[model samples]
Target: MQEIHPLLQPKKYRFIDQSTLGPGFSALQSFAMDDALSISVGEQISPTAARLWVHHNTIVLGIPDARLPYIDKGMDYLHEAGYEVIIRNSGGLAVVLDEGVMNLSLIFPNSKDLNIHEGYDAMVEFVRFLFADLTDEIEAYEITQSYCPGKYDLSIGGKKFAGISQRRVKQGSAVQIYLDVTGSGYERAALLKHFYEISKLGEETRFEYPTIDPSVMASLNELLGTSLTVEDVRERILKQLSEFSEAVVTHPLEGEEIEWFTKRLDQMIVRNEKARENLK
Candidate 1:
């Protein structure tokens, strides 16, 4: 008998699935939603949340990537490749997003006992449990050659399939993960490689970026040898959360939460504006 993760206990949870909301919400809006939701949960107005979201063609950049010497050139390349670019308020390098990818944000009330690594570990355990029937080989470690490399990167058989990042607001912890569900992971990896090649131009920079190798990344469908779609993965998450929680409620943002989201959205817009102005 394997030990169960604390996150998987039968507790109450709020489920929000924005994956089918289409392309109307930008990455900026999504981040704002996460922040606002975190605040709500922290204030005890809501329960822990498991939000699922998907965006069309977009490349979410980290602050460090925005500071690249030739970031303007990189943005141009991404734009030419038919990707909308935004700098995310998170800790990580560039990551690709598409219809085939699914993003999950697990928001919890921050506690003195819940450290940063513990939050990440909870997400890792949740994911592994979600797919336990399909495979038991999921592992979390930094894949050095993959973009957005981190100690908590989720991989299997030495190829990375997902990455996780964390954000905290008030007393809420939003642990986020993006899963490459379907499509060509290599192509996405190659796009970032080209962006980096143009952005860095072999310049000796103070910040060290990962040397991306396209082959080091792979979609879950490719790794698991199944025709897994984003919808399939989304359903897996919902079903697992239902099994883990005594009650999984779906609710919309209310008046005060909407106000908070509005303010955070404005901040996101301002942040993007600054990033774009730098590209000029």
Candidate 2:
């Protein structure tokens, strides 16, 4: 087993658990919240922070996804299928987020000194530790046929259960990951497969989008042969975080942090609107 990165072992961590916020807690706000936390940590106004969140039936698209030849039609299909769509201000292809998916963001300061791979490694190591008790077969590598495939995709055997992406801002880094803790990973991947078929319509482009194969994905419950709910994983995360830190504190955003969140949220909304305008 690889040693946990020092970045993942903070002396103290500000832990924010928003997983129970329900459907009203939009992914739009989640991304903005991460930026806010990044700035807060970078400015030394807050300690290294971790946030857990879940959104209901949303498909977060990458910037390139927004440029798909028939994306307006693709968005319409998703809307009809009862999924909200948004373009994220981060790196990676499209990914599914729903009640069964648990998302985590680890915000670290001094990004200038943090190598990009270090941020990714910290997340990989932390996740390995999160479920070390349940199974030791967890692996990190690109699951090319899976939706949102990446070099840091977490898997068991040959099936992927999670994907990691990172964003850097104001000298802080947010290494974000989405874990498919429950539900059907095949159904989720199928959604994206249909989405890409409609969005690209067999049209070729400069950047190649993934050719998704639903079988390449599976929920943790399926892989580990254990019934693990998002809530179950939520508790596990908090417990693991406590082990990694000397103290775990829940600190709400205040004053300037609130202002920063609002500013970043507005920017996200504007970006989404502009991306939509290109379709019209």
Q: Output the number of the TM-score-best candidate.
A: 2
CA RMSD of all predictions: 1.2, 1.1
Point out where model 1 deviates above 4 Å.
111-113
* Overall lDDT per candidate, in order of appearance: 0.90, 0.92
lDDT of 2 by residue, 1-280 (tens): 5677899888999999999998888899999999999999999899999999999999999988887888899999999999988988655789999999999999999999877899999998899899989988989999999998889999999999999999999888999999999999999999999999998889898889999999999999999989999999989999988988899999799999999999999999998888788773
Off by over 4 Å in 2: none
**lDDT tens digits, residue span 40-84, model 1:** 988888899989999999999998898888999989999999999
Error of 1 at 39 (Å): 0.5
